[model samples]
Target: MSTKEMFLTKLKRVIRTGFFNFWRNGTVSLASVLVMMVTLSVIGLISFSGAILDTSLVELKNKIDINVTFVPGAAEADILNIKQRLESLPEVFLVTYATREETLAAFKERHANDPSILAALDELGENPLGAVLNIKARDPSQYASVAEFLESGNTLSSGGITIIDRINYFQNKTAIDKLSALINAADRLGFALTVFLAVISMIIAFNTIRLTIYIAKDEISVMRLVGASTAYIQGPFVVVGVIYGVVAGVLTLLLFLPITYWLSKVTENFLIGFNIFSYYLHNFLEIAFTIILSGVLIGALSSILAIRKYLKV
Candidate 1:
C-alpha cells in the first residue's frame, strides 16, 4: 500500500477505536459527563447572576447623583463657568444647569394641587429657589471626589466669591459607598468560588479518565507490542474526552433557557425591569459557544494529563 493509503487506513481505525472505547466504557463516561455538566451549570448560573446584579446596580446608580445648588444672587455667567469646569472633569458624565426660575416653576408644578404650598409660595412674593447644577458621574465611586472639587478653590467662583452654597450629595453618599463595597466583595467572592469549583471539576474529570485508562492498560500494552505508535494509542482517549465536552456543552445550553425564563419572572415580580431571560436569549450564541469551548479545553487537557501515565507507547 502507498504511504497515503496507509495513513488514511490508520485514521479510520483510530476513529473506530475511539467510538468503540467510548461505548465500552459507558459507565465511566457517564460519571465524567455528570460531573462536567454540574460544573458547566454552576458556571452558567454564576455568570447569569453577575450580569443581573450589574444591570441592577447600573440602574440604581443612574438614580443617584450630586445636586449642586448655587447661593441666591449668583451670576449666570459664573454658574455656566462652573458647569463648564465640572464638564471638564474625567469622572463627570453630564452637568445640567437649572436656573432659579426653572426651579421655582418645577416646585410650583409639583405643589399645584396643595393650596397651602401655593399660598406659602405666593406670600414670599419672589423666587426663593437657587440656580442648581445636576451633576452625574461616570462611576458611583467618583461622586465624593466631584463633590470635593465643587467645594474647593475657585472652580465654583468666576469673581473670587464662593458661588456654590451647598453640595447635596451626602444624603446618597452612604448608600453609594456601601453599594460599591458590596459589589467589590461580591465579585471577589464569586470569582474565588468559581475558580474553586472549576478546579474540583477538573480533578474529578482527570481521576475519572485515569481510571478508564487503567482499565484499558492491557489493550494499550497489546497495541504497543504490535508496534503501534503513541499517537495511535492516545487518539481514542482524546476523542472520548472531546465527545464528553460536546455533550456537556449542548446540555448546558438547553438547560439555561427555562432556568433564565423562571429567573426573569421572579425578578420582575419583586423588582420590575430586570429581565435575565432577555439577556440570555440576546446573547445565546455567544454564551453557548463559550461553554462549548471551555468544556472542550477542560476535557481535552484533563484527558491528556491522565492518559500520559498509562500510555507508555
Candidate 2:
C-alpha cells in the first residue's frame, strides 16, 4: 500500500478498535464514566459555592456604613468640601453627602412603622441628625485607612472649622473584618479541596483504566506478537477513555442545572441579593468548558498511564 493508503488504513482500524473495545468492555466503560461524573459533580458544586459566597460577601461590603457625621451646625459647603476630598482619595469608591434634613427624612422613613420612634422624633422638636458623608471604600480592608483619614484633623477639619463630629466606623468595623476573614478562609479551603479532589479523581480513573487494560491483556499480547505498534495497542483504550470523559461531562452539565436551581432557592436569603441561577446562566459556557477539559485531561492521563504499564512488551 502507498504511504497515504497505509495511514488511512491505520486510522480506520484504530477507530474501529476503539469503538469495539468500549462496548465489548461495557462494565469497565460504565464504571469509568460514573466515577468521572461524580468527580465532575463535586468540582462543580465547589466552584458554584465559592462563587456565591464571594459575591454575597461583596454585596455585604457594599452595604456597610462608614458614616462621617459632622456637628449639627456644620455648613453644607464644608460637608461638600469633605465629600470632594473623599472622592479624590484612592481608597474611596463613593462618597455620598446627606444634609441633616435628608438624614432626618431617611431616619423617619426607616422608623415610619414604629409609632414610638416617630413620637420620640417629634418630641425632640428638631432635626438632631447631623450632615453626613457616607463613604464607601474600594475594598473592605481599606475601611481602616479611610476612617482614619476622615477622623484626622487634617483631612476634614483642615479649614480650621470645628464642624467635625464623631465618625461611625466602629459599629460596622467588626462585620467587615469578619467578612474579609471569611473570604480569605473560603479561598484557602477551596484551593485545598480542589487539589485533594483532583488527586482522588486521578487515582480512581487510573485504576479503572488499569482494570480495563487487564481485561484486554490477552488481546494486547497477541497484537504485540503480530508486530502491532504500541500506538496501535493503546489507541482503542484511549478512545474508550475519551468517550467516557465526554459522556461524563455532558451528564455533569445536565445534573448541575436542577441541582443549582434547588440550591439557589434554598439559599436565596443566605446569599443576600446574589442570584445563583442568573450567575449560572451568564457563565454556563465557562462552566461547561472547565468540566469537559478536566474530564478529558483526567481520562487521557489515566489511560496513558494504564496502557504504559500493561502494554510494556
Candidate 3:
C-alpha cells in the first residue's frame, strides 16, 4: 500500500478499535471522560475569571480623572483657552470645564439632605467653589506633566489669568497609582494560580488515563502476541486520547459560556465597555483547540507510559 493509503487504513482501524475498547470498558471510559471534563471546566473557569478581573481593573482606571480648580477671578475665556491647550497635549485624552455654579450645584444635589451644609452655604451669600478643569490622561503617569502645566501658569493659564489656583495632584495621583498597583499585583497572583491549577489538572488527567490503561494490560499484550505491529498496538490508545480530548473541550466550552454570562450581569457597571460573551465567542475556536490539544497530549503520553511500564514493551 502507498504511504497515504496505509495511513488511512491504520486510522480507520484505530477508530474502530477505540470504539470497541470503549464499549468493552464502558464504565472506565465514562469515568475517565467525566474526570477530564471536570478538570477542563475548572481550568476554563479560572481563565475566564482572571480575564474579567483584568478587564474590570482597566475600566476602573479609565474612569478615574484629575480635577484642576481655577482661581475665583480666572476669566472664562482664559479657562476655555486652557481647555483647548490641555486637549492639544499628547497625554491628555479629555478635558472638561465645569463652572463654579455648576460645581456647587452638583455638590448640593449629591448632598441634598445635609441641611446644616445648605444653611452654611446660604449664609456665605456666594458659591465658595471655583471653575474646575477635569483632565483625563491617556497614560496614568502623564498626569504629572498636566499638573505642571496647570501649576506653572504656562500658556494656558498665562496673561495674568492664573486660571488654575491649585491642582489636587497628590490626592488623585495617589489614588490612581495605588489602584493600578493593586490591580497589577492581583493579576500576577491570579496568573500564578491559573498556571499552578493547569499543571495540577494536567497531572490528574494524565494519571487517570494511565490507570485506565493499566487495567487493560493483558489485552494489549494479547494483541502484541497476535503479531500486531507496534503501530497497530498503539493506534487505538492514541485514538482514545483524541476522543477524550474532543469531549473535554466541548464540556469546557459549555460550562464557560453560562458562567461568564452570569458574571457579566453581576459586574455590569464594573466591567463596562467590555463584553465577556463576545470575547469568548470570538476566541472560542482558539480556546477549544487548546483544550483539545492539551487533553490529547496528556492522554497519549499517559497511555504510552502506562503501556510501556506495565506491558514491558
Query: What C-alpha lDDT do the candidate models reach, one value each?
Result: 0.81, 0.81, 0.78
Give the TM-scores of the predictions, in the order they appear.
0.77, 0.85, 0.88
Model 2 lDDT, residue 49, Cα: 70
Residue pairs in clash, model 1? none
When 1 and 2 are scored with TM-score, the better candidate is 2
Model 2 reaches what TM-score against the true structure? 0.85
Better of 1 and 2 by lDDT: 1
* Count of residue pairs whose backbone atoms collide, per candidate: 0, 0, 0
**Model 3 stretches astray by more than 4 angstroms:** 2-4, 153-163, 261-264, 269-279
Ranking by TM-score: 3, 2, 1
lDDT of 2 at 301: 74
**Tens digit of per-residue lDDT, candidate 1, span 1-313:** 9999998998888778877877887898888787778777766766776776677667767788899888888999888988888899999999999999998889899989999989988999988889999999998779889988876795646568787778889877887778877977786787788778877876776777677778878887898899878888888888888888888878888988888888888877654577888889998888888788877877778778877876665
In candidate 3, position 78 carries an lDDT of: 82
The C-alpha RMSD of each candidate to the native structure, in angstroms, is: 4.1, 3.0, 2.6
Lowest lDDT block of 10, candidate 1: 150-159
